[model samples]
Target chain A: MTITGKNKNKAVVESVAQIIFTVCASFAILAVASITLYMILSGTPAIFKVGLKEILFGTVWKPTAAEPKFGILYVILTSVVGTMLAILIGVPVGILTAVFLAEVADKRIARIVKPAVELLAGIPSVIYGLLGIYLLNPLMYKLELKIFAGSTTHQFTGGANLLSAVLVLAIMILPTVINISETSIRAVPPSIKAASLALGASHIQTIFRSILPAAKSGIVTAIVLGVGRAIGEAMAITLVSGSSVNAPLPFNSVRFLTTAIVSEMGYSQGTHRQMLFTIGLVLFVFIMLINIALTKILKKGAAEDGE
Target chain B: MGNDTLYQKRKRPGEAFLMAAIYGAASIAVLLLLGIIGYVFFKGFRVLNPAFLTTVTSSLKGTVGIAGNLLNTLYIIAITLLIATPIGVGGAIYLNEYAKPGKLVNLIEFTTETLSGIPSVIFGLFGMVFFGNVLGLGYSLLNGSLTLTLMVLPLIVRNTQEALRTVPDSYRSGALGMGATKWYMIRTILLPSAKPGILTGVILAVGRIVGESAALLFTAGSARILPKLGTNLVENLSRIGGKILQPGGTLTIELYLQMQNGEYEVAFGIGCVLLVIVLLINLLLKVITGNARKYGKQ
Candidate 1:
């Protein structure tokens, strides 16, 4: 009876603690639930009121005008084109740099280069924006003047354009691509290299033929992740892209989907504000697709390795 | 012999080109870092002064400073981590110890993954609408901290889970075998062993909290004012309750403002401050993880 009494207090405390933890553990689900609920609840009203085709396909996005056009076609196009350009440029450099780190560089050189990459990764997006404005814009402006000498357009952003945004994004995605691809490359078992060597394949030949193919899933994951980062990025692109809703010509100023919301979120009101949330929902859907792609690739890779 | 000659002829130039390209890529990565750091340090170092660090920006006083934003950054870090750490650590313990491989576990894991993958801008919008307006917190540090808690919970949970996994099963069994309850065992053995990992997660969360701008911009409301700091600790403590409800912008937000206004000199100065902080964080991370912390989306 005394032993039971002694244990009763501890048991109660244990049960309480367990309950607390279970609640805590459920926070992630609660957060996701709330976000999804809030996103859908807030994002759909504007679409229904404004018509989906008009908002998604409309070329003009003047949400505050008397006859306001809620078209995000140009904004969507800029994000898509800019993201593609960034991936096209960033992926090769990132993969090659990973190859250099994993298989090619001297241990000493790799050691030095590796920390630089970490520091690059650690740098804030805002700093990238500042640098874009500081260094990149001026140079691009000079080029713009040179290329379009005697051009009629009076508006010059001094380099704040789609080109600058793409370059900044390309650089930003580098560390993500490099780190994942490098880790994956390093994870490629050395036996694969040995097998290739035994088959009369030279070192570079083996890397391209055997090792890269082996790590293809990871490289693809890196690219998808890079694409996600580029699409979702705001502050850096906002500062550089000049925050205009326009066709995504290389030198033309533009607003990506992320920057579109940010550049307008401050003062946007009523339907204008609702439209921004709608823009966010579109972005969320894009991210969901990317995340699904990521999971699919990761799952497939795991299954293959299981085999 | 002919096959060998053909293979050799085809391989050399292509091989040489690829190798050169690899080397070039490596050089570009290095140069990009060097160029950014070099530019920031060169221009920003010249602009830094004790006054700029110490004072608040005032048009009337004809002064420029980041003292307010710096304090806000510190406040956000402290408040966000305080709100997040206990819940995060508790969640990790539950997931790693109590939960079995079941449907609930899978749901929790999926939600955690999905939460991590969501964009900060979306979080900002949600925080703005839900926390700032709907909940009537109305753009305050308290509001930002709450938003950031959700933003960073996945990180802490992830790192702490990894740490908890590293603690041996023997430790748990041994503690339970000694007549200790599960909670007691977790507290006494599992936690102490996972301290470094938990601390790493907390610190990384701090890094993310500090680096964040978009998420805080709307929720926190970029109103630049320093919190009260008098000699009386009691008075200060008492007033903090009232003060947290006031709006503030962190260092990154201020930096963005400066850049937007084309205030390069001040922007670079803020950049230098941020760079130093990030380097210090990475240095600490290197020590704790005892390895170069691999780059991943935060």
Candidate 2:
């Protein structure tokens, strides 16, 4: 093809347009990256000034008090324990649901179940929080789990404890696990099932031994994604976590890094505010590491599957 | 025959138990939806009177309507769609129509994917620094809308690209063969074909915008009353460059604030309203896409 003047000009314009779009998209990524960088860079000095042991191990979070301590061990524990609890509750149910959708359910039932999961995913966290406040809180009180030890007043009522946050987080992450697990299970080759069946294996045996084994890495990725979501979740945890900065015991009402950021960002100023940024930075690093790890694992899984 | 009998014996109870468990877990997903809808309606219905829809929230008990917040949510959706749809669609077109697979396109794809992964709270923080402080837009609807625009742009671009890619290449080739220019072929052949997908993207974006709480908390500062049509629009626009830049409280924010203040009844009521709106939008998308499919089949 001959390069005419008109064609050359058009090529120039198209290249320019592509460059501009690429830059715009790059800016969006940079926006997120810059936020993470700013949080870490600005927050580290405080972390250093306060000492890592004081920041991570100290019990108190009194950033504004005369003896300002910024220990985050409790918050970190709350997040990790809450996420673990969520995974414990959510993973089995989600895996079962995915197995059912992939292996047993009729097409008509699968269709209904699929969209229901989508709707579940789409329901906003605010509504989840509202439900927790109205339904879960009262239920906890009625179960006598709200009262601490022998207290009769039920004033504590476990209004926002590790249990409630974990339960909510479990529900929030369910769709993530279910969707991914279902897709992975469906991707398992029918030939594997056929071979197992030929060997006189039952459908159940085939699924557990042959199909699930093949989809294991994908299933792991799904669980990791769920953990990431549970760790980063804010609004639902905020409403249900009770937002107390006091070092959280297992039954005590507590705050995660996210809930702390949301609850304190409005009123906090000075170093107190910067510390909140530090908290955010902590959460950001935590989630970013999870995301990158998941991505790498997923890529390797894909490569292995391709082989 | 003996082997088959043995396999059947081994499989029957185990398969039955596993299948039952799977079905039980699947049913819970449906039950969760029912639980959410039922709880919201049960609590919210007690306070969902006509006054709640028509009047602004007041200091008086039993009169705290969400009319203003509803309007604010609507305004944010409108402004965000206005800003996001064009740019998002345009970017998608540039990717699909003009660009070849190169470093730039790959970079854009990577960036958009990463953007989608960032948590909303981070977006809130960025909005605070960039829009609120640096840009001097302060906490206003325009700032919130802009922040949301960035948040949803990747969704729009990805969806639009998928839609455009789904359009058969033959259509474009035929249009070009008929002496149509590249731009004309795209305008006439590609976009129209991808209309349903683009609209689906818009619907999804609206759902995110309406349900968003954290990002807007910083950008669109809390204001109880709806802005008036004339001076308010002007003042808001001038403040944020003729955009929706007033201190607006969306339903999500109102719901959060109400729950925070221990107004369970009102929060539930607002929650129901938001749920209904989202459901309706979803239903609209289904109907529209259903019709489009029907028409295409015809």
Candidates in order: C-alpha RMSD to true structure: 3.2, 3.5
lDDT tens per residue, model 2, B7-87 = 465447767888788888988888998888887888888889898987897776546788888888888999899988987
Q: Give the Å error, residue B33, model 1.
A: 1.1
Poorly placed runs, candidate 2 (over 4 Å): A1-20, A142-148, A151-157, A246-249, B1-8, B11-14, B60-62, B177-181, B229-243, B292-298
For candidate 2, give the DockQ: 0.47
- The clash count for each model shown is 0, 3
- RMSD to the native, candidate 2? 3.5
lDDT per residue as tens, model 1, B1-298:
5687644645488899999999999899999999998899888998799998888999999999998888888888999999899999999999998898999998898888877788889899889878987899989988999999998999999999999998879888888888999988988898988888899999889888888888888789787776667999888887766768889999999999998998999999999999999989988988877632432112
Q: Model 2, residue A61: displacement in angstroms?
A: 1.1
- In the range A1-307, model 1's lDDT, one tens digit per residue, is 6999979988999999999999999999998888888989899999999999999888998888999999999999999999999999999999999999999988998989998998898888999999998889999999999888887974676789999999999999999999999999999999999999999898899999999999999999899999988999998878789866888899998889999888898889999999999999999899888888888898899998899
Position B207, candidate 1: lDDT: 84
lDDT per residue (tens digit) for residues A1-307 in model 2: 5658878777676567666655554555566666666666656776767777887787788777887878888888788888898999999999999998899889999988887887778788899988887678767655545346677643473567767878899999999999999999999889998999999787788989999999998899899989888888888879787757655554567888888889888888877777787777777788778867876887899799879
